[model samples]
Every structure is written in C-alpha cells, then in structure tokens.
Target: MHVLVLGAAAGGGFPQWNCNCPNCHRARRGSVHHWPRTQSSIALSADGKRWLLCNASPDIRAQLHANPALWPSELRGSGIHGVLLVDAQIDHVTGLLSLREGCPLDVWCTPNVHSDLTSGFPLFPMLDHWGGLRWQPIELSDERTVTEFAIPFLTDISLTAFALHSNAPPYSPRRGTPSCGDNLGLFIVNRQTGQSLCYAPGLGQPTPLAMRFLAAADVVMVDGTLWTDDEMQTLGVGSATGQQMGHLALDGPNGMMALLDPLPKRTRRIVTHINNTNPILDDQSQAASALKAARIDIAYDGMQLTL
Candidate 1:
C-alpha cells in the first residue's frame, strides 16, 4: 500500500490567514524551522495506478494540483477512484463542493455523517446539480460490533472502523450525544502483506478497542492536534481545552504519549492533523525534540510511506 500525506495541518491549517500566532508568523516569514501545511487529508493506493482519497481537505484543489501523481492522464478526467471520509468535519467535507466540476463524486461515509451533511449542512443536496454526488454509506453494526469493509475499486485494501470517542459536528442534532457512527478509528490493512495502519485523526479519549488497534497496527497515525490539554486556553486563541475540541493532547501523564509508550517498538508511530498553535510545528522547539525522542514522526504535506 502507498500512503501519501496530502495535507497534514488541522482545520485552518498552518499559518492560518486570520492567525498571527508565533508559529504561523514564522511560517509566513519563511522560517526554516516552520513549513506551511494544508488542512488534514491523505490518499492511499493499493496499486499506484489508481488512488483512494481518505479525507477531502478544503485545500484539496491545491493539494491535487501540487501532486503530479494525482493529475489526470487524459485531457478531461481524474485519476482518483473515490473518497472515504472518516467524519463530516467542515475541513473534511467542504472540499466536495470544490470538486463539483462536471465529474460525479463517489463518497463513502457513516450514515450519521451523511445525515448531518444532508440535513444541517445540506452539502450533498447542494452538489446534486453539478457533477452529481454518489453516497455510499459505511454500514455500521448494531451492538457496537466493528465490521471490515472492502472499498470498491481498490484492490488488496480493506478497512475496519471502530467507534471512537469524539464530539459530533455542531450542526448535527446529535452533537452532544455521540452515536456509534459519530466518529471512527480506521484500521486500514494491506491484505497481501498483512501490514496494517491505524488512523485516528480525531480522538478525544482512548477506548480499549482503539488501544488494541493502535498496538496491533504496523503504523499508527494518531491525532496530534495539541501539545497540552490547556494549550488553546493558555495561548488565548480559543476558550476550549484540547479535550473539549475532541483531541487527545500529547502531553501530561494521561496523554497519548503514555498510552503508546508500552507498544512494541516495531509499531511505527506518527502524528498528523496538527494545529497551527501546537509548538511541535517548529522543528527546533522542545515539543519537536520530545516527539523525536519518543520515536514519533511529525506529518507534513507530501510525506509518503509504503507498506
């Protein structure tokens, strides 16, 4: 499997237009320690000929243009097979609108996420006139049973989605009361190699099931949205703590670092979906040094991994 990090920053991205935080400021001024990143998203391919986009970042247009591999071979076409969305965050789903350029879009998402977009956001409805949108609901089992699904048009790749602890989108009626399909922990496997990847880009608190998947996978690309629980509050950028925004901060005794400390060394760990406020964006910062000491890699745009 070929995994490409299309975009690696959190919503608003690094050097957010409206933000002048120290990190974003440095990034804007071309500091070598900081590099600009787009909103979070990735593209995967079992066979390099065709690709599956995991999440559609708001910057998908630029992301696609930046990568020649994703360019269309013919005069008017796309190499992208389809999209598999983990959730219905604005940064994740709004890119669908940008793709309504006379080409039908095939999308897969949890039914609850579909409902939120179809109702409150109405993005699916609004996109029907142009190019048309195909909705492939990711079936969830009752009693919280996790099921494996083989996405159509992709070979030797399968996905198993487990329930994750995270808040629903604000537009959703089930915002405060999360359901089975509210958020997901995706375990993507390469059937041929038996190597797996556990991806949880938005995790508030850890569950036994999530921990098990993380420990078992060959590579774990977990959330690194904030460095401390009170990062947002201390920075005076946002009133909510990292936990309040459905992110498990990497610091503290009960943080994600401690959770993965006991995992086997063979299980490569990487962090993605980083926020602009997170000091780890600065490679020379203490947070980045700590991440390196812990043997965890920080994701950046265009980073690629093969399994």
Candidate 2:
C-alpha cells in the first residue's frame, strides 16, 4: 500500500491569498522553516499502476503536476481511477470541476453527501456535460464497518468509512442535524498484507468508536486544523472555535494530543489538515516541540508512506 500526501494544509491552504497571519507571512517570504502547502488531499495506490484520490482539493491541478504518478499514460488516458470523498466541504470537493475533461470518472461518497452535491451545490448536473459521473455510495453498517465498497480498478484493497462528529457544509440548507453519514474517516486495508491505514482529516472529538478504529490501524493520519480551540479567535483569523468549525484542536485537556497519547505506540500517528494560523506550523515554536515530544508527525506535501 502506498499513501501519498498530496497536500496537508487545511481549507484555503497555507498562506491563503487574502490573509497575512504570522505563519502565512513567514511562508510567503519563503522562510526556510515555514514552507507553503496546498489544501488537504491524498492519493492511495496499491501497485502504483492505478491511484484513488481520497479527496479532490482545490489545488488538484498543482498537486497532480507535482506527482507524476497520476499523469496520463496514453492519449487522453489518466492513471487516476476514481475519487472517494470524505465530506462535501468546498475545499474537499471543489476540485471535481478541474477533473471534468471529457473523461468518465467514478465518485464514491455517502448518501447524504451525494444529495448535497446534487441538489445543494448542483455540481453533479454541471459536470455531466463534460463526461459522466458514476456516483457510488459507501454505506456503513452497525458493525462499524463501511462494507461492500472496493476500488473498482485495484485489487487487494478494501475501503471502509467510520462515523465521526461533523456538521453539514455551510452552504447546505440541511445544516441543522448531523448524521452517521454526514462526515466520515476512511479506513483502507490491504487485504494481502493486512497492513491498513486510517484517515480522518476532519474530526470533532475522539469518540470510543473513533478510538477503536484508530487503535486497529497501522498508520493513522488525523485532523490538525488548530493547535488550540481558540487559535483562530486569538489570531484574529476567525471567530469560531475549532470544534465550531468541525475540527478538533491539537492541544488542551481534551484535545487531540491527549486523546492520541493513549493509542498504541506501534501505530504511526501523523497530523494533517493543518490550519495556517496554528503555531505548530512554525518548527521553532513551542507547539512544534511539544508535538515532537508526543511522537506525532506533522504531515507535509509530497510525503509518502509504504506498507
């Protein structure tokens, strides 16, 4: 199994165009310690012949250019087989528009997300003119497994969705209630080696069910959207807490750091979907030191893991 980190920064990417926070300021000046990053996205491939994108970031074009493995092999032929969306967030699903190049593509998501894309955003009908969109639903079971879904173009790998706490995207009218299929963390297992990976770039809290799924994985990549609950408000970036925006902070008494501390040491714990305002973006910051001490890795673009 090969998992490639196409982009690790959260929504707007590091050094967003309009903002100039301290971290973003340093990154724009090309500081050695603060490198720029794209929005959150990953590519999963078992044999390197075919790739499945976890989420289509707005930076998809740049990300695809940076990674040659996803390039076209023949005339109008692409190595990318399908896309699996974890949520309907704009940053996560906006890149689908870039993919509409008269080539058929398969998209997998939960029923709720599918509805939002079709009715709320109306992105589905718009993409139909280019090529075709084959929407596949990834259903969850009472056993805590997303069953009956596999990469149609790849073998020896199975996909599952673990429920997480998340709200509907801000644009959706049906934003009042959250459901099991509203948002999800993905589990991709290599049936041949029993090596598995769990990805949760949008997290709320460490529920028992979420913990159990994380405990069972060999590699875990989770949300690192904010270093503290009040990071955005403190930096004057936004008024909402990290949780209020559908992300769990990395520090504090009930933050991700403490929740992850109890997991098995053997699991490789990496943090992705980092917000630019987070102090952890600065390697010299105390937050970075603390993260290093806790044996957690901050994911960066182009990082690769093989199992």
lDDT of 2 by residue, 1-307 (tens): 8899999999999988888999999999989889789999999998997999999999999999999998998898676889989999999999999999934789999898899999988778889898767898888644544464687776888877877886779887756577778789887798999998889888787777788789999989999999999998998879998878878899988998988898898989999999999888999999999999999999999999997
Error of 2 at 185 (Å): 0.9
lDDT of 2 at 144: 44
Off-target runs (Cα >4 Å) in candidate 2 are 143-148
Note the clash tally of each candidate: 0, 0
Per-model TM-score, in order, reads 0.97, 0.97
lDDT per residue (tens digit) for residues 1-307 in model 1:
9998999999999989999889999999999999999999998888775888888889999999988888889897676888888888898888888778834888988898889889999988998888677888887533367688987766888888877888888788987787878888789999999999998898778888888888889999989999998987888898988877788999889887887788899999999999999999999999999999999999999999898
Predicted candidate 1, C-alpha RMSD: 1.4
